[model samples]
Target: MLEHLDRMEAHLRELLEKEGGWLPFERFMHEALYAPGLGYYTAGSRKLATPTDSAGSSDFITAPELSPWFGATLSTPVADVLRDTNSLDVLEVGAGTGALAASLLPALAELGLPVNYYILEVSADLRERQQQTLAAWEPQVRWLDRLPERFRGCVLGNELLDAMPVRLFCWSQELEVLERGVVWHDHGWTWHDVPADSALSRIVRERMPPLPGYLSEVNLQAEGWMHGLGDWLEAGAALLIDYGFPQHEYYHPQRHRGTLMCHFRHQASDDPLKLVGLQDITAHIDFTAMADAAHASGLEVLGYTSQAAFLLDAGLLEHLQSLRESDAHAYVLQLNSVQKLIQESEMGELFKVLAVGREAAVPRGFRRDRLHSL
Candidate 1:
């Protein structure tokens, strides 16, 4: 850990010297999270869950924590994809702690479908942890560094795109896409604001979704990744569960600051510049942009909705009933988990679920009636 910190410090110092004693926030973020052997994900002592945590350990929780039935619910729609494409394989990206995999794989096992599960994770430490947690099902699980050449199974990613480095831009009625650069002054690093550039400024002028618009975040990386993901699957579905807003909400004119955050030991912090590579850095996803990229890449956009709606359509309530009727105490625990996931004040509203594919017509897992599009 010490060595990693030293390496990161050197990198930061170098960045400070270049570009007139500063760096773009996106550059800082990339180096902080993904720099070889020195970034937060690459250097940490694994944050994944262990058997000791009762299948519920993490800095933050996800939908799968609600119940094993969450997997069973997801399978209902996934099974349809399999039937349509005549394939039962699955590709899961960024399977943190492998909790969802542990829950979903066993359920997929019993479905009697000829299945191959692939996990693509960038963190070596977390990959090792996933291997240990999922050792019992070696026959079904495979590790990958990147997406395969050709695939027909469902592609899954939860809270994955939000972590991709986003280029931050500040906008005004006159000036647009102002760069959020950092500069080293007398004592320490501070923000160095600059005028709008050619490419991003054009984006702000032509492509920006109707937003209130004082400042906003841009995830060009997310768009690029979605395009690649869509291109990889010959015929299948891509399921993404993440925290983000549609373009309209993302660029609300009154909104002066974008959603960029850092998490250290479950505590949320607004300062990404402080910790360097010690804390996790993330930004909110833009669902509209993701869908646009998928469409541009020849993938059909099926459905976009909130996590709550998707889970419910997939039968979260049914799972609750079955589990509750059998064991009241366990049912109560599961309900609590659902509360954190779907409550309007919680992740429910904050997290949006997007589904894209080639074979599936319109995914049945979302409450499509409620969606407002770009």
Candidate 2:
């Protein structure tokens, strides 16, 4: 990992020098996470270990990685789309370790829905790992380098959008917007601020109320990605699960420092400058913006709600009931994990699920949605 970081840092140094000692934080983030084989996801690290698993350690565990029940619960909505739309294919983006695919495929198979499972993973290393994870179901599963021309069925991504590169900016009482970038100082990296682009500057001035020294992130990349997905999606729905807030709450005056976060070995911090390519860098998604992108590109928002609501509506508790065994201790452990996934104080409130689709009805899990909030 250190060697990878060193290589990334050196590569960044050369790029920084060439760009006149200035590089947008987004570019640095993009390189750190997607720069061929040296980036975090593409480098083939064990980044997704179960929270309770004793066999391995990881930088973090996404909801899908934490429990099979998560994927099993999600299968309800996916299967709903597959059946309703009469589509035979499901596309999963950025499938880490293929844990969700492994859990979901079998659940679908149990219902005798043998749909073609296609993965659109950019990380070559993680792609290989996903193939290995789903080796048992090889005949039914396949990988795609790009979106199959005019894809149908369901599309899903767990904790995927937040990883997209974000543009950082700081605003002040004077209404001055300073775009944040990377600069090599006396020894290492530090922030370099300049006049923000006028369009974003207007957005900050009008949308975000004054909060002196307030720093925040704008996920234009996520919006653009959604636009592309919306264009490529001929039919069906896309469900994105992650930790985020609506636009109002996202740029709230109280959130001065923004939702940008960095994760390393299960510990969280605000310093994306230090870890280079060894840590996971992300920012909370702005569902309103994402939904807007989808809508502008011609898609309807099927639903938007907290993870707890979505899971409950999708029958998580009922699934848990079925998992009960004679062993009381094991059952209790499963209950505890489920609590972490749904309890308000745990991931339940922190994580949110957004559903968007074209030519698809309201999703089963979105029976009582809060789309109005987004």
Please provide, for model 1 over 225-279, each residue's C-alpha lDDT reduced to its tens digit, 9 standing for 90 to 100. Answer: 9999776889989889998888777776655577888876667798887767877
Which regions of candidate 1 are displaced past 4 Å? Answer: 1-6, 15-20, 46-58, 65-67, 172-176, 207-213
**TM-score of every prediction relative to native:** 0.90, 0.95
Once model 2 is optimally superposed onto the true structure by TM-score, how far is the C-alpha of residue 37 displaced, in angstroms? 2.5
In model 2, the runs with Cα more than 4 Å from the true position are: 51-56, 325-330
Query: Against the hidden true structure, what lDDT does model 1 obtain?
Result: 0.76
Q: Backbone clash tally for model 2?
A: 0
Predicted candidate 2 versus true structure: per-residue lDDT over 69-174, tens digit per residue: 8988988899888886899789999898899998899888877889899998988888888888899999989999886768889999998899899999997557
Winning candidate number (TM-score): 2
Residue 281, model 2: Cα distance from true site in angstroms: 0.5
Per-residue error for 318 in candidate 1, Å, reads 1.7
